[model samples]
Target: MAPSRAYVPSILLLRSLLRPLPRQCSLSHRLPSAPSRPKSKTAKSRIRKPDPQPVDFIQRGISDKPGDDVLNESGVSAVEWWEEDASGNERFVSAITNRDELRKHEEQHKRLEAWSRGEEDPNEPEFRNMVIDELKKNPSFSDMQDALEAMKKPLIERIQEGEEVDKEIEAEDEMSKEEGIREAQEFLQNLLEEPSLEHRRDQILEIQAKLTEWNSVDHPEFLEAMARLNEATGGESVEEFQNRLNPYLDIEHTALGSEEEISPQDKAEMEKLAKGIADIHDLLKEGGMDPELEAEFAEMRREIGTDDWATDVFAEDGEIDLDKLERAIAKFDQAELAEAKQEAKDEDDEEDLSPEERANPELKAKIDRIMEDPRLMERLAVIKQILTGTKAFVSNVKSAPDPTTLPLAHMTTLEDQLKIAENDPEHLIALRRLRVNLLPPYNDHPFLRPFNEALRFAYVGANDDVRRVLWRSYLKAKTIPGLIENIPDDAWDILWYSQAVDWASNQNRFNHLKILQKDLASIGRDGPPTQSVGGVDVNEA
Candidate 1:
């Protein structure tokens, strides 16, 4: 598709915002330092009455871009035809006074409090003189203590009122703040809704950080207003709120990591991983499995969702649960027999109906509605978007999100990887610094940018909550064979990894990774050039 007209604008805005950001995540990043903004010529041009034109350049920047205009950080003459309203000066003066009036009240009040407490610094003659001069004009404002105490009543009343109807008062102020946020968000939305711009993605991350702060305080209310605004405009940037607000709500996230972010113990854990991979390779080559089992098992790693069935066999003590499987097989066999019997008894005319016909799409739809009677459509729409393709910022690592969501299998794999790495403490150190983690081997790594893109694509159709491995598990189930003899009881992780990779490489219609990741995917399937991951025998089956 030739890019939409709005696409470029949104991309520009996103690019501005995304400056200096790094990928995947960290508690710290290459942040934009406070730019030594040139001395605003207008700063000294004190608003003789909010000059309609840029009395100074700073004012020029503000007035030049109507709060709604999508202007760059450069001097504001982005469009030649833009004009100012006739009442701009009057309104500017009024707004300025309104702000100053409140500031004056607050300053006077604070000064009185400090003087009454006798805590005013002796060296600060300017403040002392100002207080004396103000008292001379209003002699009744004598004895600083009395004035301070007099102001206290109203201050306390105001505070109580603010506290009592805080949400209501906040609701009003938030409207104005949201207006500002919306303008900014609109600009940012335009910037990001573009063709893939990896570098710009980083900049958007920072802009998102700023938005995150705003969303944290007035989340419910702000989101509602934002929703309405978005509805009217069909803005694409609304998607970013999830990224912004989600992080703010999660206290552990900071922009990225600082020098002191990781602990020694975490470093130690990472060291074991390198060695772990090698060990698994060795074990797989020498396990007690029959050749038939080994070959069938290696080839049978179906993609995505099938691992759940695999995990059911592999229990936590790290052994297969054959009895459980035996029961499942019996129950399934019985159900199959009953289904077959019912089908045989069906009217002759309907005996050949396919599964889709049997579902009776219309009836199924009606039942689905009656059963939930909720926003099933909305949820499904979101689910479809996520499953079909990642909306933003997912990586192209080996594994993908599975729907079954049992973490035991995934966790066990990571634990095993870490265990193997135990031999090399420094590598463990680097791995430990990776705090907000996912299953290793297939994980989001900044250095591995290609993987990140693939991961994002995988995330498109998955939920951030309830474990994001849906597609991996969902699709894998489709490939299960007539006989469940290929998957071993103890090799659940292997099954998961193998299946996830194959699905991504073979079945996924759209490979989101660029040249490198697509190549990585190919190389990965072949297994990383026979390099050893510190041989610690990860093979359980």
Candidate 2:
């Protein structure tokens, strides 16, 4: 304020020229400063400028981290990337502008790659390339069960449906139709056909193998196939069929998938009577017709000594006088009848009671009750006659080590002989001894009939556990002859002891007859009868 400043216009202009250029222009050392506007006479004021920010300078086509939003002052954001797909297609992705959307898109792409490589995570929802609606429309698609029915069909049939084959057959010429059908049939047969006897012997075995191989044994189609195979290999008789299917396929002897009307035991009993009559007829044929013999034979055969013989002998008017026939035979051959009676006595005398069983109070009571019943006594006497008289008949029976070795006509005779002589003291002494070993053992007990029926049923029924138990019991008896020796005559004792033994020692040669000989001794000294044999339990008649 003291001295007035000198105004040097040229010096002021030089100071202005020396000022640095603006940032927007080139920053070279030789560059001239930009021209500035002259100062106005307005009041001087300071303009606020923002502080400079630090910048990260990244090189293109080099190491660049993701998640970085590089934006200019104009609100623009972008990043460059490279990618290669599964098909080996390489591409340079354009600079993406959005950070959130790009991150999402990248994650999805990675998941897709993992899925295509079969690296699916269990926690995620199941994913298929095709939709479910599309899968159902395809007939070829099936689960584990559908595959089972397919297994039973022949190879060609499986490859093409039956309708398709029919169509193909229809398309063929008439001359070639037979050839086509034959080829198809042969093809079907070959699916399960076995050339080896070892394999073909058992149809059940073949079916079992197929079922196991295909894991479809329980399926209905597989069952049907099994039945067809069984029918193809089925035997003519129950014995033949049973022999063919020994320790497998527990099929019962049946007619049309039902129980036999007559029990095997009853049929066996009836056959014996028929055989006896046949023997008598043959003997009469050999003896020639002496008028006295002929007249007596006619009377015996007619059950009449006179015109009113039916009323006099049967009273109930039945055919064939069994008693008169016996008398007629006795008159013809007194020595033969005597020998037969003696033999019957011998067979009935074979069984004797153990001292312990004879001493049992309950058994003694049962014995007393049985002795008191006239029906039981009469039954016992008849059995004794049959057992004692069968020796001559047995001697006449043709025999072989293997019954099949006999002629077909003789096979029936062989089976009859085996059944009749099973307890006849030759084929099976152990079982015979078991039956007759009682103090007064009958040739057969009535309970034995039902007991055997039960065993046979159990063998083929669904009671596997019981069947195994009975099998083990039978094995024990069949292998050990000593077990059958000295068993009690009472049925209850036999039934009890048989089951309690670790190994069954009964041959089951006589089925219930062997068991009935012991009477319930298995139930301890005081327990009641077990009531059930195999699956058959005895019911009072």
Q: Candidate 1 residues 1-541, lDDT tens each?
A: 8776653567778888979854643322344366344468775464233333334655655666434232334534233222245554321111112334446657877877887799864323345445544554442444475655554444344434435444643454456446545655766566567555444655655555667575542355555554554564454455444334321122121221111112345335323322332222223333232354344334433522242234333332222333433333344345446545765776574768777667456533543443364543443343344344542323544576674686764545433544444323343333322222222222233433332222333322222221223323322221221101111122222223322342422222122112112322322332222333552221210
- Give one digit per residue, the lDDT tens place, for model 2 in 415-501: 344444442323233222233121112213343333443343332232334443443444333222112222323323344444333
Candidate 1 achieves a global lDDT of 0.38
lDDT of 1 at 404: 67
Q: What is the TM-score of each candidate against the true structure?
A: 0.18, 0.16
| Local accuracy by lDDT, each model | 0.38, 0.40
